[model samples]
Target: MLIPYGTYNDDIRADIRAFGELLDKQAEAEAWIKQFDEKAASAREKIKTAVKDGETVGIYELRSQEFYVLGDNWGRGGQVIYNALKLTPPPAVKEVVDANTPPKLISQEVLPQFAADHMFVTTYETKQEDKDKFFGNAVYKNLPAVKNNHIYEMTFEQMYYYDPLAIEGQLDLVVEQLLAHQAK
Candidate 1:
């Protein structure tokens, strides 16, 4: 089974075990997949409602070539925080993928179609450099989040670890940033 990223725990182990059991049962496997889809849709609704009444957030990953959006199904810490805060992610990212699978890379051509009030960028290296690149780009300057200076930098390694301590740390960082931005 393909997952976007790794989350080491018994729950994943159990999923693996179940995957093995359902391997030969095509109907069962498809049924399980359906369940995942339903759950993801439900999560998106809850987040949307939250964003309607709470804060607006956009979770993004910057790669060398393409922009990636962290959607409701990624199972990353950003998704967790977004869900908790009831913040809806960019709706353009409609695909519901497994938590372990990588998000779809969006083309630069469609950049204008995406918008958010506040942006969280996942920086893999040189956080300032990544932030600087985004800030310097003319294509992104018109974005409300960028125009309002609401862009935030973070690292996936710091935010995506599925450990309890890691989640707590990510939660604190996400909430702190949101609160800070909301105040302004």
Candidate 2:
């Protein structure tokens, strides 16, 4: 079973079921599916509890002066990633995500105005020098999130999948980082 990169929650479950069918393990597949569903639900509820108000979140793979939303591989973008985690970006972030397709290129200058509340930077195959250079730029430095130190790190190796297992880990990371940020 070949699954496309742009798949959402149920689509992935369907993929799992398909794979199970292919392997003639329907019962096992159903069990795994139930586990995944429960995991997602638990994460969603925990996230809602952690974040009372919605926040504008920017998940990026920064390259030069341009950065792609979601991830560089275009695996999960727009509402797909959020939907998997059951998290919602504020209107500021949602508008752009809804308007543009996955792996949307958001120039450094413009993105800050849209979603400067929280940012997740992907460092997969990205040079430390380039990241440091971007960090020094006035545009990056001036962002409210930057000043407030609301920046967090994610890896393409992990987040690119956006599968049930990946999202379980992703939700934990998000909650941990957000709670830590709130504490500060």
Best by lDDT: 2
Per-residue lDDT of candidate 1, residues 34-141 (tens digit): 554455455555444223454456667776645777664353555444443445555554332224246666665566565566777775544566657765788878
Cα lDDT tens digits, model 2, 69-131, are: 652224433223455564556565565556545566767677665554677777555577878
**Candidate lDDT (C-alpha), each:** 0.57, 0.62
Best by TM-score: 2
Candidate 2: residue pairs that collide: none
- Taking all chains together, each candidate's TM-score versus the true structure is 0.60, 0.74
Q: Which residue runs of candidate 2 sit more than 4 Å off their true CA positions?
A: 1-11, 71-81, 90-100, 162-164
Give the least accurate 10-residue stretch of model 1, judged by summed lDDT.
7-16
